[model samples]
Target: MKALSHLNKYLLKYKWYLIWGTTFTVISNLFGIIPAQLVRYSLDLVKETLDIYFLYNGSRLQSNLYDVFAFSILFYGLLILAMALLKGFFLFLVRQTLIVMSRHIEYDLKNEIYLHYQTLPLSFFRQHNTGDLMARISEDVSKVRMYVGPSIMYGLNLITLFVLVISYMVSINARLSLYVLLPLPVLSVAIYVVNTIIIKRSEEIQRSLSRLSTFVQEAFSGIRVLKAFVREENSATNFTVESDVYKQKSLQLTRVDSLFFPLIMLLVGFSNVLVVYVGGQEILTGRLTPGNIMEFILYVNMLTWPVMALGWTTSQTQRAAASQQRINEFLAVKTDLVSEKSLEREIAGEVEFRNVRFVYPDSGIVALKNFNLNVKAGETVAILGTTGSGKSSLANLLTRMYDPTDGVILIDGIPLKEYSLTSIRRQMGYVPQEVFLFSETISNNVKFGMPEMPQEKVEQAVKDADLYQNIIEFPEKFDTRIGERGVTLSGGQKQRLSIARAIARDPKILILDDCLSAVDTNTENIILNNLHRIMENRTSVVISHRVSSAKLADKILVLDEGEVVEHGTHEELLAANGVYRELYEKQLQAEEV
Candidate 1:
């Protein structure tokens, strides 16, 4: 029961269901005791009437012995039938109430975990793998439900039946009741020892399973890489290693679970032997009758099922405890990011960064240092940088994906932290260097940011991205299903689709971070031409390595090694003879070649 303390709140919330379910289970077991009692009474009646051919009724009316016997059998048969029906009805209620409550709790628990996942900072996700999270919510959740539902119901049933049957056995013969009770203490100790091992082993099995799931998920995600490298054999070997680890852990858990039932059976066998040995002597010594012996045997037999169930229930309870501990670890993690601001207003798209500095957690390298930028409303600022020059870090800060370690970022003259996260994020449309699309229809992907966006707006967005001609070529047009991560679409098409999705939201600020790198130069020019009209009076920040992409910007800032190196208009940067000029000359040489 201590193992179930983690679920106490849920249990208390559904306390009424537990109460009613247990009440019905107790009632069902009470009715279950009747058949054994009736069998004993019938045998005693037979013994008493063996010498009489006819019996005298209370009114001195002689009745045939056959009729008397028939009447008694018929009366007890109906009693047993009625009790059986009642037991079945109550048992059904027990399952319906408690099991359904467990399902409801499972749903609520999963939703809470998912909500917590959403609240956690980006760094938390960077630390946890997708497959491990999936395993916690899926497999571990089901395991907890087993403890909440069937294990609980069966446990209640065993307790109720054990009490009633043991009481009846004691009343029939106190000495024999003592014999039956002898094995129970040893059985309890065995359960305690075996279940301790079960808890540890179940945890190991769950962790191993999570590793295997992660391996499979990663392998499938990188199947193309494996195929391109012709490394299927290596991947198979790695998978076998992980699979073997999981198998070994599962076998260890099974070995622990396998010990409980046999110990219970041995104890039960010893109890039966005691019952026969003790009861036969009592009957022969004229202290007990044959009918009394039968009654004690029946009661002992009734105890057997519950004793077996005790083992099973104990096993399930330990497994569920192991799962509960795992889930609790996730729930106990406090979210690093907290939203305290209540401001929710339309953004005017004026952006500024003042002496902003940032370093990623556990990394000594700085991503951004003393970065300063101020873009007035309706200005288009382009950022030029090489790999690892903090281009994406700026976009991440603007979107509030990560907060600056030092200095302030302001939106519309207000501190970024003063605004609600949702309001700030909703006002910005970002297209990252690595584009991701859901496995959905093209129209759905386009409307992903704003699901209720009008169809006409979706069409206009696609047209603006210069993707209309390519999209209409598909057999299903806007309704075409792009498979996982939009794999069926070319890299350029995926980038364009990502742009359309952002534009469809009609955000106040548009941040494009190297989104056009996948498109050809000719296509990039066409898209830029369309963007000129879209960028009018819209605060936009474009990050790219291409000089051609920055030519139309109101300002261009060059970054080298996480610090701003130079800043000017495109023409001015070209004449500055700095990092920007060097990069421009190299691109020109490569293109000319």
Candidate 2:
């Protein structure tokens, strides 16, 4: 019960539906019980009225009795038909209200989880896998829905039937009712024992499924790498191992269900045998009529379903509880980053980091130590560094992808914490080292950052990124669909597309973290030349390994091992005979070759 506490609020949202659904289920069960009584009465009528019709033909008693018998059968048949029709109608309403509500809850829950995913910091994604998250959103939510829909309604139906049937049986003959109900306590104990195992196994099954989903997602995402390395057979063997584990867990759950459900049926069968044996003697001694015994048997037969339902409801409830626990665990995660205040004034792109230090959460190794720099409006500052020198870390802090472990970062002299994340980030355009593009049209991908931009502005951004001519070469031009991660486009084209997307926003600050690395040096020069005019009034941060690219910046800062080694214009750094000079000379020699 504690496992399902998280779903209470969502269930309350549809309380009216729940009320009506319960009403419909109760009515349906009540109607379903009526046919058994009608069967008993119709049989008794035949026994009482048969002799009169044959012995006294055309007499008043005969005529009246015959008419009564005929009418009873007709009424009995009509009642059965009417009950069936009414039960079907109400059952439809039960499904509409309850089953549909479950689907609605599923929709709400999935959306909530998706929104939570968006709000989580990068560290959370680092800790969780894409496939596991996908499984929770899809499969786990579906399992919870089973409890919300069928388990709830069916459990209610079973209760209604038990109350109505048991009360009627007790009224007919309390002795027989007591004898027939003897096995139920035993069945209850069995259900409890089996359901405990079911719950544990269900949790294991869900976890195994999550692992399987994660494996498939990873395998497909890295399919190219695997094929290039000729690891197809190895991947298959790994997949088979995971698949077998899921199968074994599933089979274990099925085995438990197999044992428990049949045990319930056997208990029901035993109760029927008891009623027949005890009531047969009562009929012989004239204490109970044949019709009375038959009615009791009919009532017990109706009780069988509730008995069977007891086992099913228990199993499904346990499974749902397990799934709910997993979902709640995920939803309970608190993000490390949040906005404490919102700045109403727009950012001017005067970025400064004062005595900043950053250490990754997972590694606990400092990526940047005592990092300090300031870029005024209308200036371009290029960050040049070796791998792991925290070039990208600076861009991350500026965009609020991460916060420094110590000290402050400010945009226009205001602390980053004072501004809302979106407010500060909205002013900045950042292109990461690795670019990702959705499966969408060329134009759609370009306008992803600014969907409502004028066509002329979009075209200008494409031209400025130097990707316009290549896009025009496609048969449908901007309308052409790029495959997943822009697999349909060349490496250089993908990077250019990312640049165009960033430029489409016309942000006050632009940070390109090795975005144009895939393009040729000539294309890189062309793109940088185009950005020169655009960077004239806005601050720009370029993180690059190439000295040729950084040479265009107003100031070039060289970083080594997470600390700044030198800072100056390209010519001044060259004359200083430092790290920048060493990199420039090597690059110049490489290009000359």
Best by TM-score: 2
Model 1, span 45-90: residue lDDT tens: 8888754544454433345566777799889889989988998999
Clashing pairs in 2: none
Alpha-carbon lDDT of model 2: 0.88
Tell me how far the alpha carbon of residue 268 in candidate 1 is from the true structure, in angstroms, after superposition: 0.8
lDDT of 2 at 136: 91
Query: Could you estimate the TM-score for every candidate?
Result: 0.95, 0.97
| Candidate 2 wrong stretches, greater than 4 Å | 51-64, 284-287
